[model samples]
Target: MSEDDRTRAMRSPGDGRPLPQRPADGLRSGGAPAHRMPGGGPGAPTHQLPNAAPQGPPESGPKPGGSRVYGRERSGSSPIKPLRSRREPSESGPPSPRGPGRRISGRTVLKIVAGVLVVLLVTVVGLFFWVNSRLAGIDGVLADYEGRPADTPGTNWLLVGSDSRKGLTAAQRKKLATGQAAGQRTDSMMLLHIPEGSDKPTLVSLPRDSAVTIPGKGRDKLNSAYALGGPKLLVRTVESVTGVYVDHYMEIGFAGFVDIVDAVGGVEINVRQAVDDPKAGLKLKKGTQVLSGSQALGYVRTRKGGALPDFERTKRQRQFLSAVVKKAASPGVLINPFTAIPLASSATAAVEVDSGTGAFDMLSLGLAMGDSPVTTVVPFGGNEAVPSGGTAVKWDRMKALALFDALKNDKPVPKDVIDAG
Candidate 1:
């Protein structure tokens, strides 16, 4: 800051008193004793205290009285302290100008505070509605399917990471820089389960190449479900595979994802590797960094990002999600009321859900999931080589099913559900 700025900061807005001290309070602290005011010093004033009614002499001026009224010397030199009791009444004894009367009674102060909170509450609620109104045309694609509670027991969101680059104009393609519409398959897929009775949430990352039979689609690539059908088909396919019903679904395309990130400012994420992806357009040094929408989308979309492939990216996405949850749940953020409305209105606006799904249900579920520790379902189990396609992952299907059934029953998912995975 400039010296002038520093000087301005040091000086009070009006008087030169220190910034921490109030102007009203500074006025009270002239050579006067800390507690005394023009009102009077200490206990009952001299008039209230015992004193001879009157006395003679020019020292006292008494016209009505036959004798003179003289000030009495304080008795025994007893030191006096200011009267601070709440019970003291102004009318009982004339209260001092610095009234021994109630100094804004605690109950009254509390009421005032409550009144302020009510005003703020109304203001924030107004802001929420106003900002939400500003957001228009956010409705995106809506696809719905039947989802069961996680068999591993708890709510689960089966997020599908799509690689749909098709149906884009040249300008739109140039903006995201993902190149022309190139269609192959979904980049990644994962089953996010919140155990019914399980306190911590676990993310079970299913390999897109994992072999599984979609309900009626026959056996195929998990990402193929999206190509065959969009999120509705994909979620249905997942529900069929795991026997776990999905309670909710969120599908964020490249553009929507970027907008959501930018709306909430950005998020802090830890990077263990130097991501050098010319294809996805991500280039970053290793360590912790705040990623905006486009960068975040890249972080979750990079398939050749590290030795572990997109698994690292999925992990990053999960952590980023957790941070987002933390920020949303904080009172400071929620109190702003306007902050989350835009991001949430934007984010959810893009999401596709079951026909009856609404914001409150989504928010309640999110809050529950946020409080739980997030766990992943990337099984240590090996994958079986597909005859021609990518390898099929070998999973303990029974155990996984049992876990989901347990979630349906709101019971703890077996520890083996996690251990076996």
Candidate 2:
């Protein structure tokens, strides 16, 4: 088409219409594109463009159509900002109420501690009552005796290890080498004297074969009194001989002794010399060794192959007794209910105490013995054949009296007396 014709066609339509003004910069004031209707380019009728977005100041909050304008205007294309997991506030602003975290209170902590202590207290008390209930009570065993010596300054207990096979079966008797002795006999006897003050407790071993006058049987082996009249006659004879009051009598038998040793796992003893005695079923090397129930019984009972049979036997008895007391009081036994409960049950069942010896008395005696006692045998003059044909132990009169006097008055025995026995 000719230039004059094209120009006339493009310009002739809006030659008389007013055009809208544009901004100096390309960007619109509100950061949105300035828009207009499709056919109203030059405002041919001067009507506002239909469906046009608002063009307000860039600092205004938001567009009227719910769209946001960022702080700085974009140059070309819009790039997306990564979303944060949580919104961050101004640097100097207060913390959010839901952000600080939880804390435990002092009152809750105290309640927890109190609950723990109450549980422990109940456990301990229940154990105490359970142990108390297991103690066996012996009554009327000493009631028949009369004219006993009056109470002395300190306590004296007659602790006897008897050779009574009351609970032993034939197999057990053979295993223990405890011969089939028809009746109960005192295998070991000890005068355990606990002095009134801080002086150490003294344990004096009395030979079962000691020649002593039985209350009505005249002179005989000391053990005969128990065989004849039981605990009463035995206590009477002991009181008359020592001149020390026998306040309590506690006797343990063969089977029970073994049970106790086993229940506590075993007793540890230091043997000075190698011992191999078939009669007592003991075969041990000389050293610090742990003896089981059967082995411990044999260790305490063996008298064979010794130059001084009864004397050496009594010494072994004292050593074994001390070992037993120490083992029983140890944490391995006392703290473990598996051991302590069975031990207490077996011991109480096998032991026979005097009528007056209560659970408290037994407890005191056991505790006292837990402390190492000074062990000695009664001073012996000689071991010779008696009129009855068996050997009988003869006590040194002067030394024996001195020992008894010291024990009765709660005084220390002379070194000579302690050394002589």
TM-score for each candidate, following the candidate numbering: 0.63, 0.74
> In order, what lDDT does every prediction score?
0.60, 0.80
Model 2, span 1-421: residue lDDT tens: 9995674455444664323445423455534444444565443322224554543334555434343335543434455464545756535656665666345579989999999899878875776666556655466655545677778998999998989999899999999999998988888999999988998899999999999988888888999888988877888899999989887888999999999999888888998889898988889999998999999999888886467878888889999998888778777787677887788778777787765666667667877888898889899887666656687888999999999999999998888988886
Predicted structure with the largest lDDT when compared to the true one: 2
Candidate 1 matches the true fold with a TM-score of: 0.63
lDDT of 1 by residue, 78-186 (tens): 4454555675564455556574443566998999999999999897667555544433221222343345323434566766556655444577556556766565466
Model 1 regions lying over 4 Å from their true place: 1-111, 117-154, 164-177, 182-186, 195-198, 378-421
> Model 2: what TM-score?
0.74
Sliding window of 10 residues with minimal summed lDDT for model 1 = 24-33
> How large is the C-alpha RMSD of every model relative to the true structure?
20.6, 9.2
